[model samples]
Target: MVTSLLTFLSLTAFPPAGDHYSSTDSGRVRLASELAWESGRLSGNQYALLTNSSSQRLFNLADSLIKTERAAVFFSPEHGFGTNLPDGVHSTDEQYKGRPVVSLYGNKKKPLTSDFGVADTLLIDIQEVGLRWYTYLSTIRYCLESAAMAGIPVIILDRPNPLGGLISEGPIPDSTLMSFVGALPVPVRYGLTVGELFTMAQHQNWFPLMKDLKLTVIRMDGWKRSMLWPSTGLDWIPPSPNLPTFQSLYWYSGTCLFEGTNLSEGRGTDLPFRWTGAPWLNPADSILFNQSGIRVQYDEKTPVSIPGRAHKPKYENERLPGFTMKSITGDRSVLQSIRQVILSLQSAGRPLTIKPYLFQLLGSRSVEETEEEMKALNDFRIESRLYHFYP
Candidate 1:
């Protein structure tokens, strides 16, 4: 299927997947922004926009219908517009696509009433990489909260969750450990897309201000419940500095837990999460973890790559033997990966102490080998499927 960034959403609907999708089954979805504009929804109504660099292609295509004058101001999440900023840094306010861009990740994490100015609606056109730990979901919540307080309507131009709406992983975090990263009570890899999440949030009234707040989600044309990231026909733009490829995004589910440990998550290298190691790890250790259903091979040669914002990646330039992660399919569950990592750490090397922060990362107990912990993992997988907004 030849999918262009500017293509209008198809009017056609597809049937459920058979053994696999045929040429007759296609979901050439239009961006919600396009539907809104073409349908004259945003023709004259002023709005406040929450978007970033990734959506520029859509913005350019729909520019005739969506002018800067229609937006009172613009908002951006982490990594700045189009990932122009480095990881972990703040985005600065600037003019983008003709409107004044406000830094939601910088001085103000939430939009204030003053930020809305004269806008009556909040248009969300951002792309989400589909992890609760990722910051875009937090930005959406803040935008919704501020819009609710100001009594503004929010129209979400829904995008694919990239992970699709099927498989979810890890346990949900209890209220105590919740922060900017794990802001929601969902599992580490919650399956719902941004639009579905808002629907659930409003139905459950997750926020006090949104009880009567107006919410409209423009669903996509052809997207189905079962398609994975690669199936979408969209290019894999790096959602963040660390996850530069679809391969990296897939590997991230399990590998990201390395952040909680003392190991280097391949930050300085071109392949961040995919290349994990520490100066303490042994090359022979990769063989021990190979039995855990993940291929972990020690690299003897250095890979060429661009660095993120970090100038000094941990273990930079040193040929410390580290393992390369190779799980890029949802066929494998995250808890399975976590279990493998824990068992590998115990058997492959001397026992190590995990930091408390891991609880926040995995949204469950630290990677301990226990029956109760295992039950939590199973319960998370079974319970989270209830939140699937698609299919």
Candidate 2:
């Protein structure tokens, strides 16, 4: 018997013993912190950590080896160490779990020697949602460059990209479009794991100071290019406040584009990125979006389905007619969702302006405004020629 592509992609259940291991089962892929402790590598090493609440277990594993949670201090990214802050709301320094956590958002987008205190190594294990502008990637680059200045090594305990490490999509970001949202230009749905990305950056000399920085990535085991979240057999940890489920995360690439426009993006609703409707659009008439795979549904295709909180979604009490998203191919097809929504808005004469922010939200990558949507992205010279790490 032969298997289908969908069958291979939808291989969700745990594999048998001694085969492909997962943290859920065989635990083949160990966290860098965990591996360090087991190999007696943490001894006599003064290392600072760059982590958040979702990935705190890595820190804890390290602490168990060192016998003290007392680091000189800890470094935190966007949502703070506790992962409790709302989007765009600046977080102040706070003592979390007995260690001072420094904010890495707003003007302080990168790390400094001061943030590291007396430590000489940095451990990064933030669960990135695999989007170019998710900011974790930027945070990693900053840490790399700062580690170079601080003369330290960065050990990345890589996490599985929710969208998997195959099938790169969307356009390569223009150099002019660089921001905290996008440190280096890659596809919006880049296919590399965080560690793989770091390796590429280091080899590409993207970070001049850290081009030769001593970097190590503790990679996952049993993961493949085409596998999505379910195939990993790992649980979901919300990378940000807005994205609460695999469904929400899958729909994020598409719905996130709405942030650039005036549309509500289902902010206040329970399905932040999953369902979108604006006051001007009517639900019954289907004012826009007639793409083959585009859809509006309560349950979306994913390894799992989870309902998240939307305290004050856009058009709260008023009726806003919009569409829900689906993952005809893993939710990574966010560009499709985005392209359709833009067409819908254009058809409705909603004045979808291409402000600088619109491009920024799209990670500065070029998207066609006309009906001919992008099926394949324009490959970058750096990506195709020099920086690629995958086979």
Candidate 3:
């Protein structure tokens, strides 16, 4: 059995220095769900799980809860219960393992009071990719709101931010620009784990109504701020269909910007988010990266219909010239890379038509404006540190 939170807290009060850590150390990290299960924290309560296939792959929390008769109902985020629905598609209510599964991404983005049924507690265990546009963060926020209004305690099983917690990039979203995609005021690449983000949310009054909500974060064991997904020794499961690999996720923070343009962000292709282009672009024109250990090479790709993943994706069935990016070392600055791509496309006489949706994605009017605002992140960085569970 795993140690109690009290014992774990005292042991991890002072994290080890970053230089002494090994990236290849398997089994060094223990998930909060695993610890919670071993310690029997989930035995007595009927839990309404806000989770997806990624969490199922990681620990099978739902199956365990059902096996022990502690599952009340299951909740799914943007993609659906099994994550088999395409982007922007609404998932209808379904049955999973003889229990009702409600879709939070359907007609209603938040759970109704009646949806709770017999559940006394709300448990969130979905994996997040550490980007503002990832809808899982918004789903969690909505669930928190529902839990607060319903007068129930919430348990969050903390997971590592695939991009790591060492760096944050881009600018905070304007209050007027807040939507399901840009729910929080944090930067595009906010460096906090899901647990830390919600903790900071309650403390900082991001959602003033949730201030009194009973929230408990079952913290991960041996996870450090410097450790990325690979460093944590956790298997990589695609949180969403598009982000299939770490390389795809690494480039997503920057390349996702293409979604607002006429260019294809590699959707319907095997390399979604890793490859970006349009038929109008010239392959001979090179895109440069200022960050070290980064390489961008010219290539050609064709997007096609992939039922559950992407259907009728942008410029589907057309071959287009694009560039693929790969990182040889650690995480590189994604904002800088975005700027570089913008300049390169402009220089190639293919000036991008700025879509209104781009502002929502960047959380700013333009890349240049966002870059200017990024100069003032020192305060946010410091303020965020107060809620850090790991060093």
Candidate 4:
């Protein structure tokens, strides 16, 4: 099969188009759309799909590009191929569209020598949840390393940050605790697309051995740094199971901290990150909780929601109501506010525990573990800069 496909490519002629391209009024172009149509990087076996909404864009482009005798491959991240797997599920090798579909999550987070031998160049198009802990971001870094090792060029088709590029939050991850979640010193809400992230990653010199890395980014035309996912005018496909709506991710950067606790983090419920709690939480008592100093650090609003109506009372209300968040003026203030709440809750013997440890979420205990570090955590939000894609 490989021999036959290789022969077809050897005899074909693919023309290169101009740098910029546009979409028609009614049509939605996928990430693979631009690169697939033109000839430069199509010769090698093509591969993509490691994160949320990434496969949608990749497959759309692959179907558009794959023609007579053209062979393309698609891969998946922490979730299995097609992202049918729930969060924390491992990926298994599979086949779809008559092409090889490999797993980039779980056992094979990083690419081995064999993956590169299958394709000459690789293309990455994933929808990241914008939080640092999400595995999708780590998958991208691993791909960069693999492509570098194999001497293959990687093209990233960027997408918008759902949290909006206007604001960034969180602290600089200590180098010692760097993991897939904290790939670099980036803030929790690093407001850049996968393409922009590639550029930043390069500048940060995180992968120094990947010196020969060949990368080209197909930047979005209609996107602006300030625009959130909804403003992009692109279809809203759930990038991950939990990120069902833009609102989910909008509140995730801070709310995700709940993951370290015994709290629900709203996973079993419909709202996931947006509606977080354990049975012990009294919506009435906790109503003004977020308004406090430490709680405010994690939530931008003085009051994250109205008390009794917080959960939307699964048995009664069907529609999820939202409350206005208090405008947070500074990151340090936000952190201070959140710490106050957490400590208060703990002292009150609230079911919440420090076990999951806030430090685990940051991928470091350095800043969150100590009073001085927590002070630094509050200041991390102020340092984050919004990314601008174009002039």
TM-score of each: 0.84, 0.80, 0.90, 0.75
Model 3, C-alpha of 30: deviation from truth (Å): 1.0
Candidate 2: misplaced stretches above 4 Å? 1-32, 57-59, 62-66, 284-287, 297-319, 327-332, 351-354, 369-391
Q: How many clashes show up per model?
A: 3, 6, 0, 14
Candidate 4 global Cα RMSD: 9.9
- For model 1, what is the C-alpha lDDT against the true structure? 0.69
Higher-ranked by lDDT: 1 or 3: 3
Q: How accurate is candidate 4 locally (lDDT)?
A: 0.57
Total backbone clashes of candidate 1, pairs 3 or more residues apart or in separate chains = 3
- Consecutive 10-residue window with the lowest summed lDDT within model 1: 11-20
Which candidate tops lDDT? 3
Score each candidate by Cα lDDT.
Answer: 0.69, 0.63, 0.80, 0.57
Ranking by TM-score: 3, 1, 2, 4
Local accuracy of candidate 4 as per-residue lDDT tens digits, 70-185: 44566578766676666666767777667666688767778775765456667776777666777788888888888888787777766666666655555657777687667766
Candidate 4 residue 53 Cα shift, in angstroms, is: 6.7
Per-residue lDDT tens digits for candidate 1, residues 1-391, read: 2243113112111111221112332555455566555556565678788877666564442255254467677888998865766667887888765667788898989988998888888988888877888888888998998998898988787777888777766666777878788888777776777887776666555677777777777666556668777877767777777777888887777777777777777776767778777667787777655666677667743423344445465555777667887652445675567556766786655545577777787776656545665576576565444434346
Candidate 1 differs from the real structure by a C-alpha RMSD in angstroms, to one decimal, of: 7.6
Clashing pairs in 3: none
